[model samples]
Target chain A: MREVFHQSLEDVQSRLVEIAELVTVAIERATKAFGTSDVTLAEEVIEADQVIDDKAIELDELAIQILARQQPVARDLRIVVAALRVSASLERMGDIAEHIAQLTRMRFPERAIPKGLKSTFTKMGEIDVQVANLLTEILRTEDLALVEKLRTLDDQLDDLHLSVFEKVLSENWQGEAGATVDATLASRYHERFADHALSVAKKVAYLATGEWTPDTDSIAVIVAADLAAVRENADGAEA
Target chain B: MREVFHQSLEDVQSRLVEIAELVTVAIERATKAFGTSDVTLAEEVIEADQVIDDKAIELDELAIQILARQQPVARDLRIVVAALRVSASLERMGDIAEHIAQLTRMRFPERAIPKGLKSTFTKMGEIDVQVANLLTEILRTEDLALVEKLRTLDDQLDDLHLSVFEKVLSENWQGEAGATVDATLASRYHERFADHALSVAKKVAYLATGEWTPDTDSIAVIVAADLAAVRENADGAEA
Candidate 1:
């Protein structure tokens, strides 16, 4: 019975990694579509999200079955619960990717790229890649220190997001509707992507520390304050 | 043992409802501060959010303890998990309310109110109240059908949000930077509040159906398409 339970545990972990891989592709495809204005790629990302969703449901059922049958204890139980949350974070990440894709599709053909925002957008894209990499690391290594690092990495994304808005507003380019919309949406997508990544980090942190301090508000505050400062600076310039 | 376990479950549910109430008050306070430029109320919301966060952590630990000690099964397990998610959502909702307060405090004292946007802002406020009500309903009754109805109600909030952007853009009342910032932040808060409520609904649905659909994209498409139609209709008036 113990051997069978261990095998089931192994199966659950492998399936979770599979779902994570699907989510990674979804993020990559969605970010690529946003950067390149590739509507077809964006649509593909949107369609493929359903697969990740399906996998999450399947994994949840599997975990519940294992819990019911084997009744995992202590650390093993934590692993099962962590699997549930990781799947949830991956699913939310997939949803954010779909949101980005939808935004791309909405502003298509004309390709409303924000002016002087390319580097900022590219930086956000890099941050997103970092998040995906960290998720993979968490899954494979279960490194508590690395998971702790994600909180700071999320802060970095917050800082980049501020720069994106500041660069847009400070240039006195407010009249360009398309550019403004693109910048706003891009920043939102990046922020949410980082948030979902942080959710994964928090799960790992909980597993390691057995204490849950999600730190969502701190990240939100950092991002909000940065944006507020930019807007204030813009107001001063206008005055 | 079972009686003690059931009583703990009841205690957890009561705390969850209390947290929900606090969040609802926070949302109201924050919105009022936004409308009236009341910094004190904004500060009050910010301070209250910490208590909400503490409650969330407490409830999570309590649920985990119950699960560890009681070894609940099937329906009981679902209830515990749903309680965890509800606590998380309430905490996130509190964060958003605090975010709105922060934006209000930062942008106020300048006191630039948008002339024609008050009605729209008020409408967003109403939507927020509806979201709060839905959350209360979810907690009080746990009715699956009512939870499903929240998706449709979320569609209404999305409509109000698009209308906000259209009104701001059409009027070209872009000079009042503070008001524009306020409107933008207000709209964002409303949208996020609805999103979190939808998340709670999804959790409830999952608990009841034992099936998770991950239909965020489908719902987004519906909302986006509806917004597009509204925009098209508004454009026709200009033409």
Candidate 2:
């Protein structure tokens, strides 16, 4: 039974890596297609996303089965849970790729992005692919050291995302409302792709460390302030 | 042991509703604050989000305990997992509310939205709060009927969001770059808040039905085309 459970764990690990690889390819193609306005390639990325979704569903089922059948305790249980989250993240990355591809498809023949911003998007695509490849490695190894690099990549993506706004704000920007909206959304998609990658890495690290760090922690202070506000409201009601 | 597990499940459920209620309040105030430029109210909502986060973490810890201790199978297992997902969705809703509050705080004493878009945003905030309150009921009852209403509410938000874009695209858009970005992001946050609520409703429906529909599917055709492309590449390599 123990050996069988270990094999199941190995199966999940392999599936995660499979998903990571597939999504990495998706990002690469989507970015390439977005940068060049390749509608055919964009269509391909959009269609490939279904496979990623199917794979994610498969992984989720496998994890749930393992949880029910093996009843893994402690770290083993966390591994299963984290696998589910990572699959969801990877699947979302695929959807982001699809959203990017959809933009390319939407503006076929005419470039979705104006000429001035193409180079900026090119940089985003390059960094997106690099971060995606690193995500593949992170899933495979679960090495804590690699997570920091993903963070740095995410920061760079943020800077690129910010630059999109800078371009929009520039006096030289001649694009209409449609172009600006598309460019903003496209930049957001890439930035969020990296952000999801960062989130997945953080979850994996949590699985490794078993530490709890709530992103929002000052609720107690907020609660006290809230009570005071309620009193003030009561004072208003009386008045 | 079964009784203990059920109690723990009940405990998690209670915590979920608590989080939902708190988040509902957060949304109400954040939007009110954003609409009114009430810096005090905005600060209150911002600070209250920490409490929402804390409650979500507490619920997650409880659900994990149930999983590890009871090792619930099949339906019960799904129940615990769904609770975890719901907690996550609720926590994210708080973050969205916090973001709305942040925008209000960002432009204190000045409106985050322009006069042209105020009526539309007013409508968005109303729909947001309504959907949030409905979500609280859905969590309490899991009544599939409420899901459709939530979807309708979400559609209303989408329409309002589209109007924002329309306003931005119009020749009369008088807001500067910062305002445009702020308006776009605020619209997105409200839309996503509704989207998340819709997602939770779907999740609850899935828990009830045992159906396996991934929200994003139809990637198979893409994969077949992708395979064909790979083969073409291989053939070219051989040539």
Candidate 3:
């Protein structure tokens, strides 16, 4: 029975890594589509999102079954519970990718990168893709070091997210209402993708170190404050 | 042993209800602050969010402990696992309320509703508050009938969310970049709060009905498509 339970745990880990890899692909393709305005690739990401959703559901069922059958206690039980959360976060990351794809598709002939913020978005997308990859690696190998690396990338993505807002809110900005809307939504999607990845990384870290951090959206408040300061400084300079 | 497990389950249920009540209050205050530009109220919501966060963590610890000590199986095990998911969703609902408050405080002395869309956001905020209240009642009563009502409110919130984008993208829009950003972020936060509530409702329904629906962000994609259609039709009429 112990050996069987051990195999079940391994199954959970591999499935998590598998879902993470798929999320990585989804973000990579979605970002590429957003950058190049490849509607076909964007459509692909949209359709493939269902697969990720299904995989997450399947993983959840497996975790529950393990709980019911193996009756894992203590650390083993925590591992299964953590898998449930990691799957949810991964599913959300896939959804963000789909949102990015939908943005590209919504703007078909036109670029979704919006005018004057292409480089910032491109950088943000690249960083998000890297974050996804690192998340997959961390889950696959259980290396705590990758969690810190992922956190750094998430910080960078947050900064880029702030920059996107700064550009849009600048006095010299000339984009139309549609462009502004797209920039705001798209930057948020990109930044949130990395945020979800970092969240998954933290869960993995918790399973290893046994020091759990409460996962809350406190980052938004800090980011919002920084944005307000930057906007105020810009306004003061203009005055 | 069975009686002890039953008691543990009841404890989980009551704690969930407690957290849900706090969320209802948070959304109430946050939305009120957002609509009236009450920065102090917004700050209150923001400061109080940590309590919700801490409570969620405490609840999670309790759930983990139950899982470890009881080693429940079948429906009992599923109940504990579902409690964890529900707690996470409730925590997220609290975070969304905080985000709304942050928006209000960030634009203090300046209304966060954006010009020309005050009524839309006001309605959205009210529906969200209603949604939170209903979610708390449902958790307390386990009345699956309320789930349908919750779904209806969520649909209303989604429409309002779509309309915010429609107003922003319309040619009649006169708001500058700041208003656009706030509308985009604020609308998203309001819609997501309802979405999280609906998700919890579904989980409750699942617990009773034993029918599991995959919880994915498919709603965003559908809403995005609807917005696109609305935009195209408007453009066609203009042409």
Provide the global lDDT of candidate 1 against the true structure: 0.76
Q: lDDT (0-100) at residue B235 of candidate 2?
A: 39
Lowest lDDT 10-mer window, candidate 2 chain B? B218-227
Clashing pairs in 1: none
User: Local error of candidate 2 at B98, Å?
Assistant: 1.8
Error of 1 at B212 (Å): 6.0
Error of 1 at B68 (Å): 1.2
Question: What is each model's TM-score for chain A?
Answer: 0.91, 0.88, 0.98
Candidate 3 segments exceeding 4 Å error: B237-239
lDDT by residue for model 3 (A154-235), tens:
8898889889988988898899888888999999999988888888888889889999776767678779998888778777
lDDT of each: 0.76, 0.80, 0.90
- Give the candidates in order of TM-score, highest first: 3, 1, 2
- What is residue B9's positional error in candidate 1, in angstroms? 2.2
- Residues A95-187, candidate 1: write the lDDT tens digits: 888888887787676453566766777777777877887787777667887876776777787888777667666745653443455566668
State the lDDT of candidate 2 residue by residue for B139-189, as single tens digits: 899898999999899878876776677676566677765567677778878
All candidates: DockQ: 0.40, 0.19, 0.80
By DockQ thresholds, what CAPRI class is model 1? acceptable
- Per-residue lDDT of candidate 3, residues B97-172 (tens digit): 9999999988877787888998998999899989988999999998999999998999999998999988888878
Fnat per model, in the order given? 0.15, 0.26, 0.80
Best by lDDT: 3
B12-43, model 1: which lDDT tens digit per residue? 88898888888888888887887787988988
